[model samples]
Target: MVARSLLALCLAAVAAAHGDHGEQKIIAGPLQSLWYNRLPGDGGTQADSVFSGISTFGRLPYLPCLSHKDITYDIAFIGAPFDTGTSYRPGARFGPSGIRQGSRRLNLYGGYNVPLETNPFNSWATVIDCGDIPVTSYDNTYALHQIEEGHYSILSRSPATDADKKGPSLQGKTLPRVITLGGDHTITLPLLRSINRAYGPVTVIHFDSHLDTWRPKVFGGSPSEVASVNHGTYFYHAAQEGLLRNDSNIHAGIRTTLSGPSDYENDGYCGFEIVEAREIDTIGTDGIIKKIRDRVGTENPVYLSLDIDTLDPAFAPATGTPETGGWSTRELRTILRGLDGINLVAADIVEVAPAYDTNAELTTMAAADALYEIMSIMVKKGPLSGLEVEAGDDL
Candidate 1:
């Protein structure tokens, strides 16, 4: 029996060397592999599931829109990894990546948005992730300019949608929209500047636990002009820069303690009507939604900026500032859905500091899902206003 086993082993080795084993045939067509089974580009193969591939927002195609002007997309996700402006926390600079990581499962369940009755990722719009803007950690002035220029670079591109398409635009051309992932709330100032260049002045729907319109002086003035722009004071600068539409913009979910009553007065002067966090208890989500819709109207371009801290800390703890008694995740999602037909030109989800989050990654996940809702509304109401696109203007 031992001699028979040895002879069989020798024969098997000889058959393996000759690539001819009984009942084990090799298939011919290109070596019969799964490696080439993917769609075009680096989007990974069909075998590479959600948890494995590169993390782009919603697992969308990552295009470097800044340099690749030829590639047209209807909507883009750009990350602003600048958190130097945070007063309470310093780690939100990583918010962009954290938000992207949280967004890994966004398209996992077939990318359907049931409430809006549409699938944004598979709709008429061509969505892509433009990666993150290169921001400097040392210099605020140059960093802000980089952010503004980076945002404008993407904003000025020709959209994949047709010129005659019903969507946002400027200068008689079809323009694309962007959803910015926060480095911190300070990035909004530069973003507003970029948006102002595209659409004259837009009404802002500011959702946060604190009113961000605090004057630099009120917020304990910064030594330099660039230093003056923090998460708490960007809206003030935005107002001063004429980027905000007066009496039309609104701030919801405010619950933070202020230095004095003058803070509210100043917030008003900065062109915002406050909807305090406590009001959700009395008026309910629909009432809050009505207030936002009424204040923002449906005609003009609207920029919705949502800070993660807008949700109660229990729901989203990984933010620069956490305030109690904020809206629940469900309530905020409902409110966002209520703004379905509004002319949402651009929007942002900011202040997702993953370092402070629980092991469940609650904050970044909430931010990503909120952005999903925002994208749903944006896609549902395809640039209802007939503004034209800007052809590569970086002003």
Candidate 2:
């Protein structure tokens, strides 16, 4: 038996070598004689046959428009390819394409035994990749309006009973979770608006280098006024509009500088917990997780907004805004992984501009990987399962 096994292993190795070269190599060993199997690539087909018919790595199904019937998927991935709102960089509008290309090599199944396909209920949940949202050219107002419309369309038809035909109104169905791939951080404004209209109030997990609370920075009457609607001050608008409740609903990560204190503390503004790089370094990932849970609560609906600049510039330099010191990628991953109990309702990865990247690959990859980490959590924990309450439960 041992000799037969050794002969089989040797024949398999030889077959692999021949297949790599697009050639056919037959073996006439005793093992082959007993099995009577055909030689590798003996059918005159291309040697790439082994990989044919399989889905491309990370290439998810694309459904651009959302109808009432298509809300069964647990998560919908949408891309926002606009970046005119960037404060420091000008090319983030290309973020979605770059991230898609970068993520081409990642498999849907977990890599290295990670089991990413498993869901919170121990059953696989449907995750669909909706294509990028169409953005108007060089107009932040138009772009914001477009994204808002798109999100509302999805939310309106989110809970469909039939997978083939459009179902009745979602008067009693759950909404589909929306995961956006952003052109820049500014896109979050409209997204937040849509969520606020639907869910009332939700916690925001913001990862960035700057506080992004400059209200007047781009408010002047100039061509740049539209630019004010960009990424640097999105959170300011969200808080000012009462989307983010001023008490413990917002958590800022890796903050190195404040855009301005008054911007954060003005009357009627929502309160937020800013976790500076110094504090994160001191308390570590475990402590940060505890703090986040304490503030957002384990069951509250949460939105995760990750800007690639939250990582140290050394590791993620492809962003339009790169800070000198910030959290490491591994540390950020650990923090995200630890949030398994938090109900992640919606999420986005923004500010990835490939033009600023020397490698043209790292920034989008970082964003895509961060997105994957979030998706893995959603799959494992189910969409806000632990956070949602029964209809009769007390608030």
Candidate 3:
């Protein structure tokens, strides 16, 4: 009887506590306004360009080349939706769609934390969703050509007539830049070709688990066969083609088990520096940042190629060749923030294979978030030009 009475008293106390703190529910209409009205029901009709998925990057106006009579933008967001190059997993071909879907709330559309320093989506940066390049998965050589040509088409477009950094894209400078939504890391080589046309041979800041500098295999009298070309060997081709500066090129967060000593020896021969994934824990993100900045410096234009597998499988499980241990998402964000002031010419975030993703679309969501940071770097215009974040002192 004494125990029963005590239990009853405890239940009564819990009920009382709940009653004391219980709050009234907020009405939906007012709630939407406070959050930029970017919720599903808050959207305008699909036909409404203002509210359409193709028109905005996250509730920000999308402004595709077809939407306006003056179809020019400062930055072109292009998608290379071909995953045929993937060696292990086969779903990165869906990277663009997955990334764009996850990008729904990223802009002012109830997105979390808009940078007070600069808004890349606003009038200051004319960003266009150039849509995906149609690559026939069967033809690897043609697909690569299509990818390169797609970038060229966008790059060749005159920048918004007025690229006023202070105003809207219609008024900003014609600094035509392209950000590729990758099907795989191989997409970077094609993208590098286009960027090099715009800004000479660039210093590449490669973020991945593998060196990606493997030599190409010649097949059936032609090296151009799709089978001969793969996601792993593009960096090697890039160096030989003079598309990327060999000496200053660097690879970060790599933790893959190399096939042989010659593998790393080849990477070194290709003029690439590797920052092992374990080093993130040892040198810390700050140390990694200093090393990257030191390597790229201020002279050479930089191209950043990020393979999602560089992140630990725990944080990014949906990549093609996921390694066991790698950098966490937080570490990547911090490192990217540190690179704010570096001269960024072009970039891509690849290897997001959603087949292995969580039900919550975690991998796709991470890809979107990583793309957001990459866009933020572009908005800042150059290294040290963005969000004035202080460097962490830990190594």
> Which model scores highest in lDDT?
1
lDDT per residue for candidate 2 within 130-179, as digits (tens), equals 56778897567988999888876765444222223321112323566778
Q: Which ten residues in a row have the lowest lDDT in candidate 2?
A: 27-36
Taken over the whole model, the C-alpha lDDT of each candidate is 0.81, 0.64, 0.68
Q: What is the lDDT of residue 99 in candidate 2?
A: 79
Please tell me which model should have the higher lDDT, number 1 or number 2. 1
Instruction: After superposing candidate 2 on the true structure, give the runs of residues whose Cα lies further than 4 Å from its correct spot.
Output: 1-57, 66-72, 108-123, 159-172, 217-228, 259-268, 383-387, 390-395
> Can you write out model 1's per-residue Cα lDDT over 1-395, one digit (the tens) per residue?
22223334544574576552221221212101111233335544345466776788887766567766666677889999988999987788889999988988887766889988988877877787888999999998899999999999988766766645544444645678889998889999999999988777789999999998888987857777877888999999999989898999899999999999999999888889989989988999989999999998887778999999999999999998899898889999999899988888889888999999999998888999999999998888764335433433321
Per-model TM-score versus the true fold: 0.86, 0.76, 0.77
Off by over 4 Å in 1: 1-46, 164-170, 383-395
Which scores greater on TM-score, model 1 or model 3? 1
Best prediction by TM-score: 1
Worst 10 residues of 1 by lDDT: 26-35
Clashing pairs in 1: 167-383, 168-383, 169-387, 169-388, 170-387, 170-388, 170-389, 173-388, 173-389
